[model samples]
Target: MDGLNWNDVRDLARRVAQGEPLLLTAVTRSILLRVAPQVGIAPGNAERALQSGATAEELLQEVSRRISNGSRRLSRTLADVERCRVAGDIDGARQLLNDVLAVEVVPHYQDILRANLAALDDES
Candidate 1:
């Protein structure tokens, strides 16, 4: 995390989406502000944490944890959506994927998610 920043986060997220996980270490306030809402954390709290002199490593750890958790949730949701689709529940799957798309997501991850959503739309 010592050498990490928002760019690292973006890259890591992208790599992860592509089945890779380049290590990351940055988390600037502006980046925090953008990522906070997606991860259910308030921007003010993220700012406060940085203002309190939290190291980039510590903040990166927290951010990485949140991203990991979000990724897991998204995976589960995708599974659910697949089940729904298999059961002839097109609307259910579509809604589930839509909700997933609305969550705070890493930039690269967001692209994959949006693509999945679009594919779902085509299927429907």
Candidate 2:
């Protein structure tokens, strides 16, 4: 149920859309919770899909659209960070980075954020 709430859904969608990890444990659990039973659709098959690299669209309806919007938010956040940095506002950049980091991201993106924060540190 981790990815069911609006904020968590959006965050999960962002991570999934970014292709961070399709085989997330939380995702599989979320899919299991959100997926309604279909006529003649095997539970095993659905479980398989959840285990496999199924996209949010594949797992649940309207999730893909939510994921798309979440992707846009992610992109806009990144752009905002760049814009603030470009404007030479180190505090602003740090604030933006902190806000982004407050959300859940896969480990690699976390590294990129650490790097960003480090670069910000080097700026001031």
Candidate 3:
């Protein structure tokens, strides 16, 4: 989250767009591993795809989709969390944060979820 590098993402996309073969060179592998999680695609999932002969184009498309959907999902879920808290349903709010944290792989989103959960704890 702290050292987010959009240049890496753009480079990957450029390679894919140019129809470059996705050879698992050390540099390529590092980019794939690092950018995957930052964009909300789980690292394990990306690794599996890469190992299973997925093209860079295919992976890029999937990352794009995940980034879009993940943004909406986080926003909606956070809204629900706020609703629960406003309704005096602390347990419900905690549960919502916990649920997000369970599947959230992005460090920034995980931090947000954890912070919300901690706020609920403070209120208690």
Candidate 4:
């Protein structure tokens, strides 16, 4: 809840999307304070509590809790993709994976993503 900045929020969002955890340390909170405003996430009085300290798991959990209220198709898609992967439905998972490459993702992530997609293609 600290005053999150745009960069911080973007970084956090990117990390979250990439399945990485974000630590809620003082540094992380400060960055969030700077980035949140840019993303329209209001920095409420809860900043003090966040500043106290939090783990990446805690931060992710908090973000999930807050975002869960909003009806976003992306969230549903991500969940579906995860479920498909878990269920060994490579084709289903590949179809869901294609949606992410439309955005500019990091090269390393992109490579891994491509590899995953290729694995699915190989199965066919």
- Residue-pair clashes, model 4: 13
Put down candidate 3 lDDT per residue, 1-124, tens digits, no spaces: 4377657666666676688766767787777777788877777877877774466557766665555566677898899998998999999999988987888666677888888889999997
- Mind giving the per-residue lDDT tens digits that candidate 1 earns over 1-124? 1322446556544555576533333534556556655555566666666654334335545676777766787789889988998999988888887787787455545666677778888987
lDDT of 3 at 104: 68
Which candidate number would show the highest TM-score if scored against the true structure?
Answer: 3
Best-to-worst ranking by lDDT: 3, 1, 2, 4
The lDDT of model 3 is 0.75
Candidate 2 TM-score over all chains jointly = 0.43
Alpha-carbon lDDT, every model? 0.63, 0.57, 0.75, 0.54
- Runs in model 2 lying further than 4 Å from the true structure: 1-71
Worst 10 residues of 3 by lDDT: 52-61
Could you tally the backbone clashes for each prediction? 4, 0, 0, 13
Estimate TM-scores for all models: 0.54, 0.43, 0.63, 0.33
Show model 4 residue runs off by greater than 4 Å.
1-82, 86-88
- The root-mean-square deviation over C-alpha atoms between each candidate and the true structure, in angstroms, is 8.2, 12.0, 4.4, 11.7
